[model samples]
Target: MPEGITAECLMENIMEKISDNLPKQKNASFFEDDKSNSMSTQFNRLFGRQKPVHHLLGGGKSADVLLWRDKKISASCLTGATVVWVLFEWLNYNFLTLLSLAIAIGMVAQFAWKTASGMLNRSPSEVPHLVLPEHVFINIGKLVGVEVNRGLNFLQDVACGGNVKQLLGVVLSLWAVAIIGSWCNLLTVVYIGFVAAHTLPVLYERYENEVDGFVSNALDQFQHNYRKLDARVLSRIPTGKFRGKKFE
Candidate 1:
């Protein structure tokens, strides 16, 4: 009876021990989950973005079009861009020539409409001439100026920012762009970028978690490799000493 009682007591004690440790094990798992979440957040804030991609892109009609929130509008814009690209590229139409042709066609259509409308005893439709507003041009100039200054600032930062990885990335990107520009005309390059801008952002937003996780993993691996490279080679390179010129 005593042996059997001791065996029961031992079994109860083991159960109690396991019960006692279970919460700690759960807490350890929770801690690991929290750590991983923190790391993911850190990685995602790589460009210091704290807002949604749409908000970062201005959250206006332009953002909607880019992200394709309004499918009809987005599709129309894409269709229009495709038509322009076809006219400019496949049809080999010159910009000035196309403009003149369009104007001529409009004038002829208006003249015919006026003649038919008079015969039909109806009011003729107004002829629409190209009347670009001064304010529109000024607004466009401001936007272009802002973008140009922003680009200049980014280049300056890369040149003197002391972040070797960022500098390397910028250099590689510029080199790649140079190669692409060599292969295609400026309009084709711009059109390709327009298409990518229309597509990539929405996809990233839709698959935010997956994209962030994948990018974080890739970045972590890149940083690990970069650290090794820095340790082995870059760390040994001597920085040049700048000597100031003597005053005359």
Candidate 2:
């Protein structure tokens, strides 16, 4: 009657109780057949078949980690896109040209983010489309994407510079641009479009992929741990008593 009693012990007790009521020979065969059948059913339930669609979509539980990951990525992209856009606007000085450029950046950034978001929302059965539509994203969004991507690239190059001098050179160049003429019309539109095409969603996508990977790894660890404990503890009771005589 303990909360954590083993299934084998519980089944043995049940068999003994049944034997007391039934003829001895009948009880032995009955218990043996019940054990075999219960094992067959358990094996089938554990590994024999695929999941139905209704349960996969609407059931309160799912075994697929990808489902959880897609949701997390979608949410992150939406939040990140909005926050980054707002911050870029606030941090950079605004004039008519700058505002126009910012508008262009956002327009492209949102679309880029949306592509990644769509992939995250896609089902496992569906094919993922990593390529973004150029026709849809206009000049302004392209510009924003370019700036962010260039910034990221500049950092990467600085990090991997062959010597300290080169690294310092890269840093100085960036500082000079920021201090002297980042606000000026650098014909930033062309570069922005090119960079946004590659960079914007890619960063968000990578973040999402990392989050999903982390969650998946964690869940796998939990299920592995639980299976080891559960088999020893909960898998031995009579099917009739715990799972009903017939599985529906």
Candidate 3:
């Protein structure tokens, strides 16, 4: 070969090798980026919570009580609940009867205190008046009203939203509640749930990792089964017009 032509051919061969290597490097980086992105895509934690359990519970005095940060207050709450359950369930006390009895006793005690203080020639200022601030009741009523409205709106939305999964979930939840209510009365169920609310969060917070891992595994398995079920059965269900987009 002539020297000039040989040099040109060699340069072309080198350029071709460089071009081929550049694409391979780019493709490798592209795949690496894709793999990293896939790895970074995290499934949701339990209940889809992105915050710590304390923050999710509002990170306030209420959360403190629920998580038993103040053991005394938490104990007092459980004790009070126990007392109420005992009163209604074991002692068979009607709420109206208890309320009336409590009011009557309070009135008698207040009257007796005033009479005794007067007979003792105690100063009028010595009599302490038991008074409730009106705003306390107003605030409580507002809170209750807001919660009631919210619950009603949620029920209405779930009823009319036409989401099968959501509807089934609500139905199953309500059905479970009904079964529990049948086992005991409403008060028993409420008390049990209140107790669980006080205890479960603390336990979950203590072992969040294990619980999360277990829940994640269970959810994955459930999703796997659900996909199979959807493909085999739910997908076969005739939707006709309802198969289209929900809102649009």
Candidate 4:
């Protein structure tokens, strides 16, 4: 509108103004603050309002202080021994009878201790606590709920064209697990898993570099084989435009 200002000059001025207002670089601190707040909020939503309980009986530090110690090794050993015992007893063992015997022994021991304490006029020892606190169960429930929600969200994402290949691979892996699980008893699977959980982590930690190298080599070999297979077979298949796009 001014006498010396042409349309080009006006456009240039507007572009410069826009460029001046644009951020030159991302603020790392701002993003870090946001991420911390988000994680804190999620943590609070899961466990903040729950009542504190004794740490020895399924509370905070229970896993690290109790289960992660020599007790884990002892439990693993007991599990292995039990499996061996069952195999040896193949047809003659009765789990119910064994359980009843254990209960009877425990009851008798408790009763004897109480009688002795009463005769001596001494205080009776408190019973060993095994029950988990309500808060621990609540936290577990919340974790399961979150995982279920995440799985549903993943399904929705897959349905909406969000990486079909990766999703299909995950589904196939789960299906394979289910097929294998069909041949295994739940308790056996759990016992093996429990033992592995305790043993594998310590092994890996003790041999971190060696484990990393082994894993890296194995992954490389797998990828190489997968690529060769893909080229030999999958490449012949015609994926539509949407199906062929690379997912981030």
Candidate 5:
């Protein structure tokens, strides 16, 4: 909230507050503590852990829970999208057209690398240590696994009511169409490249926005969580010892 403070700083402050009262035996880096893990851990633990913020806000304003929820949604959405794009490219790869397929693979790799670099550069304070598997095939398989699980979850939830398998099949079909169409005519290939290239910026922008929104939501969640913890700490004391005292 400070005037000059960057979004990264705000996010760190938020996460620090949220994780402050919890056990830290794992020594896991903060960036790795994603919402998918945190939410799965259960918010109810905030009470058993004697999280003070809960007691403070009980009778007052209702916590604006939307921020954290939205943050998770946004992060999942963008991550899911990138994974899907990469997968679609691979699913349609044709070794018969070696040159085009090679170019496509290179482009996908470049985009993924660029995305990773952009994320790290945006928040230099948040160091993301990417773990590369021992073998290239294993690494690729891991990425595909992420896409399969995470992407499916996103589709089932975000694009609700669609048959996931059918949807994936359709995407694969389109990939084939694009490739085949490209081989049929130079104009088709140029058109495909032009369309996809023009749309790339939009996708990138959407991805960046989702990441930023995720950070913002995380900060808000930390603040709300802290407020609950502060409240709990105050209740244990005698009324006379500290009257209407605000926890800093």
Candidate 6:
């Protein structure tokens, strides 16, 4: 009905308003209070007793809701992964082979361009200095060690702090890594993770408020369910005392 406003533009404006209205941040105290209240409610609901085994069979409605909300992104990622898998199978080329071939072609193209430029300008060739394979390997090894140490420190801090939520997250992450590792080689996983790390963060930053709201809501639901389970079972188990000091 408005001038210069197509249906697509109207839809975009509405989506932007929705994203802007979503919650982006909350205080730490609020989270702490919510956690305490959730645990209390869970304990009260279960009468401080173990829940029935049938409870384990319950479906995650909250997760389903979140997935449905982000169905477009999820479907796109799934389709892209399937396409990549099909291409890999048909071409019979592993990650390393593809990477090496790409690098070789890039280098050859750059060298040819440099040579042509020198010939056209009648000047000295501008060949780039290349590092030896041994040096490259050493540098790569150091980088790997640094990343491994950082990952270890993160786990150590989570464990020492005795944060049940973070500990469970780490454990679940390890399980996911194990499953992914079983499905594909380490190089392929690394390549996919590298691309995702670069891409997902940029997209998230662009839609920060909306993404944060979705994540916060999902986490709240997960914590609510987890607290119920914890009260009914996990709280009954005796974990040995942790010796290390907790880090903030």
What is the TM-score of each predicted model, taking all chains together? Answer: 0.73, 0.18, 0.71, 0.51, 0.18, 0.42
1 or 6, which is superior by lDDT?
1
Candidate 1 residue 26 Cα shift, in angstroms, is: 11
**Residue 88 in model 2: lDDT:** 48
Alpha-carbon deviation at 216 in model 4, angstroms: 2.2
Of the candidates shown, which would achieve the greatest TM-score relative to the real structure? 1
Candidate with more favorable, higher lDDT: 5 or 6: 6
Candidate 5, residues 1-248, lDDT tens digits: the string is 56557877888899997787464534445646775566644443322233333233342222112112245554455455555444456465444665687779977886777788788885323436678667998889999998898866754443343344445556787799888986665443544564454344344334644544565667779979867865786345443221332222
Q: How well is each residue in 65-134 modelled by candidate 2, as lDDT tens digits?
A: 2234355654555455555545445455456666798889976887777787778995333436579777
TM-score of 1: 0.73
| Tens-digit per-residue lDDT, 1-248, candidate 1 | 99999999999999999999999999999999999988669767636467889998899999999999999999998888989999999899999999999989978988999999999999988766678789999999999999998898778766765666677789999999999989999889888988998999999888887887777778889989989998998888655434433332
Q: Please give the ranking of all candidate structures by TM-score, highest first, separated by commas.
A: 1, 3, 4, 6, 5, 2
C-alpha root-mean-square deviation, candidate 3 = 6.2
Q: Model 1 Cα displacement at 88 (Å)?
A: 1.3
Positional deviation of residue 192's Cα in model 6 after best superposition, in angstroms: 2.0
* TM-score (C-alpha) between model 4 and the true structure: 0.51
Off by over 4 Å in 4: 1-108, 116-132, 159-164, 235-248
Evaluated at residue 146, the lDDT of candidate 3 is: 95
**In model 4, which range of ten residues has the least summed lDDT?**
45-54
Instruction: Evaluate all candidate structures by whole-model CA lDDT and list the values in order.
Output: 0.86, 0.57, 0.86, 0.66, 0.54, 0.67
**lDDT string, candidate 4, 1-248, tens digits:** 57467877989999998786565334566788899987655443312323322242355443343334566655656577667556535545567877888899999999999999989999998998788799999999999999998887766666556454666687898899898789876655765676665566455446655665566667779889989977897667655434433334
Q: List the residue pairs that clash in candidate 6.
A: none
* Prediction-by-prediction clash tally: 0, 5, 0, 0, 11, 0
- Cα shift from native, residue 77, model 5 (Å): 28
What is the Cα-based lDDT of residue 53 in candidate 1?
90
lDDT of candidate 3 over 24-105, digit per residue (tens): 9999999999987655433446766667889999999999999999999999999999999999999999999999999999
